[model samples]
Target: MVWIIGFLVVALFVYFAMLGWRGFGLIATGEVAGIGLGVGVILLPIIGVWLVYSTLRAGIEHQQLARAIKDDGRELDISHLPIRPSGRLERDAADELFAQVKAEWEADPEDWRNTYRIARAYDYAGDRTRAREMMKRAVGQYHHVQGR
Candidate 1:
């Protein structure tokens, strides 16, 4: 549990740290602050890291989005597609997001919405079998969704 918390904190720190770098970049611009150059120098490396991470993440998302589009045979904005909100998807859930979700449903699987998001995370991370099981459970539980 402690390890999990620690991991979450570290992940959160990485995200905000990147934002801080970006903010610093905008604030320290020469035209904006005159001292922007000086401040930017101090902040550029951090922001550069942020930019690199962002670029890479975007590329991965694009790749997944393409896969999703191909699988669905329709245009879809992958970024607009919601995930489980773990933010862990930054690295772990790329491939599955690209491959699985866009595909058609199988066999009218059981209701498992409670687990659906988790299954998506697993799917995004490329754990299709586990995701499928979760989906089956979610499908089985479908009646509950309408308070049935």
Candidate 2:
């Protein structure tokens, strides 16, 4: 299901990119307006491509982590996790949740699952930088243990 959506998004981006490129070719090359349009035409596609690549990469990484967690046979209790209508956790709730998760992570710094949980807590807290850092750590540990 997600793959279908991803494919549709990529197709849309590609279609728009082709149109932008065609528009660039129709503009007079030497005109200032043409230069601006050309830049926009080039940049928009590049940004779109980057977006697609990053999103796919992140999804793949997350899926791999989920598989690892499942295979580990340990359950993570998220019943008390607070989420808002926007699909994000409330700041105060996230902070409290993060504190508990952080303690567990500190207790076993080498556990990839714990690290991943911490990353998720940070993510819920709207701290993407910390979340990414924790995810990197989690991935590294998983890879190391898996001999990958």
Candidate 3:
């Protein structure tokens, strides 16, 4: 899986480089419209690289936090939760679980562990937007606590 993802990322980078080369070719034309289009095209690769780098960094950080939490035996356990046919947690059970996790987070908002749990709860409850928000918070808190 890692190899596959790495290969895909490399391919994406190559594609972005090609686009950047084309953008430079356009800029070399010295026409106003070509220069404008060239600038826009060049921005695409720059933005793409930044997005990929940031996403991979966050994923690595999240994995590190998960490993630390597991080592400390602080990982959230959802084994008792009811599951639906599609392999997701039943909606009601997920909501109840989220309520419990949210209360824990509220009680000690400074704790990265609690924040991580709440993020997972939000994910399980099918609230992707909130889950991503909480996960980003958890990542920042974890980094701060680790002095990283």
Candidate 4:
């Protein structure tokens, strides 16, 4: 799995580099419209690389936090939650779980563990935006606590 992912990432970087090369070719044409298009094309690869780097970094950080929490026996356990046919937690159950986790988080908002639990609860409750926000917060707190 790691090898496959690495291969895919390399392939994607190659594709982006090709796009950047084409953009420079367009710029070499020395036409006003071509220059405008070339600049836009050039920005695409730059932005793509930045986004990919940031997303991968965040995912790695999240996994590290999860591992730490699990090692400490503090990871959220949702095995008892009712699940719907689609494999998601039942709405009411998810809401209840969220409420519990939110209270924990409120009690110690600065603690990465509480923030991580709230993030998981938000995710299970189908609030993706809030989940992502909380997860980012948790990651930041974890980093700070670790002096990273």
Candidate 5:
């Protein structure tokens, strides 16, 4: 009967109410659900802190690279983009800049673009083993994004 089914549903929800959720308590469609609100309370601050750290790290590395780039050394000509994405850096007038970029990227694996550049740097410097490792990390990240 409809009444029996309804009662069973309610009972089922009550049995599983302790899993960081209130079960079926907030069932409104098209509106922000209670579970969503609960998740937002926990996830937002963690993500915010992560983003802040990433931004600061990137800024610091950018400044260091810019200073290095201006000095006299073997260098690679790059575009005017203030923040260069990771790639294989060339041996031009700015090789020092490329070396700095490789160091920063090695210290932080979260920068996917820089990972590729660092790998290329090592590859060019005849460190094939390190280059392969960095390339593997980059490939792993790429696969993760694709899966998502």
Candidate 6:
């Protein structure tokens, strides 16, 4: 999985480099197209920086959450989670497992940790939309908790 992630990062970098190269080529023409391409080239790095920042911030936040959970005497044991080799969960089993967590989440909808836990379940179940929605909620609640 680490190798896959590394490969993907390299691939994305190469892809973005190609795009920037093309943009630079267009900009060299010194035409109206140059202005547009120049804008694209500028925006690409800004977006890339934002992406990296967001990913790193999420990692930090997740680590914080794990620490908080541990301090609260809760153990997050995800080893039993039925993830397949395809990076998706076995849907039926995931659904069954998530049902319990869903109940927990429903009981305390305002708890960011619960929200994040449910989001993980949604991700394991391959429900990206719900996972993203839940994660947004979780992040919002976390920010609220932090008085941010």
Off by over 4 Å in 5: 1-98
Q: What lDDT tens digits, residue by residue, belong to model 2 across residues 11-41?
A: 8787877967765774658688887787777
Model 4, runs deviating above 4 Å: none
TM-scores for all candidates: the values are 0.27, 0.71, 0.95, 0.96, 0.34, 0.67
| Candidate 5 global TM-score | 0.34
For 105-131, candidate 1 gives per-residue lDDT tens digits of: 342334232344455656667677986
- How would you encode candidate 6's per-residue C-alpha lDDT over 1-148 as one tens digit per residue? 7688668767777777777777777787889978787778857956885796688577677667767777876544667767778866678878886897899999999999899889877877778899878877888898899999
Task: State the RMSD for candidate 5.
Answer: 18.2
Which candidate leads the pack in TM-score? 4
Candidate 3: 10-residue stretch with minimal lDDT: 56-65
Which residue pairs collide, candidate 4? none
Return the candidate ranking by TM-score, descending: 4, 3, 2, 6, 5, 1
TM-score of 2: 0.71
Positional deviation of 32 in candidate 3, in angstroms? 1.4
Better of 3 and 5 by TM-score: 3
The whole-model lDDT of each prediction reads 0.54, 0.82, 0.92, 0.92, 0.55, 0.78
Task: Determine the C-alpha RMSD for candidate 1 after optimal superposition of all C-alphas.
Answer: 15.2
Residue 101, model 3: Cα distance from true site in angstroms: 1.1
RMSD of each: 15.2, 3.4, 1.0, 1.0, 18.2, 4.2
- In angstroms, give how far residue 27 of model 3 lies from its true place: 0.9
- Where is model 3 more than 4 Å wrong at Cα? none
Worst 10 residues of 5 by lDDT: 19-28
Better of 1 and 6 by lDDT: 6
lDDT at 110 for candidate 5?
Answer: 77
lDDT (tens digit, per residue) of candidate 5 on 21-66? 4323332233577656656544544565566566555445544443
For model 3, what is the C-alpha lDDT against the true structure? 0.92
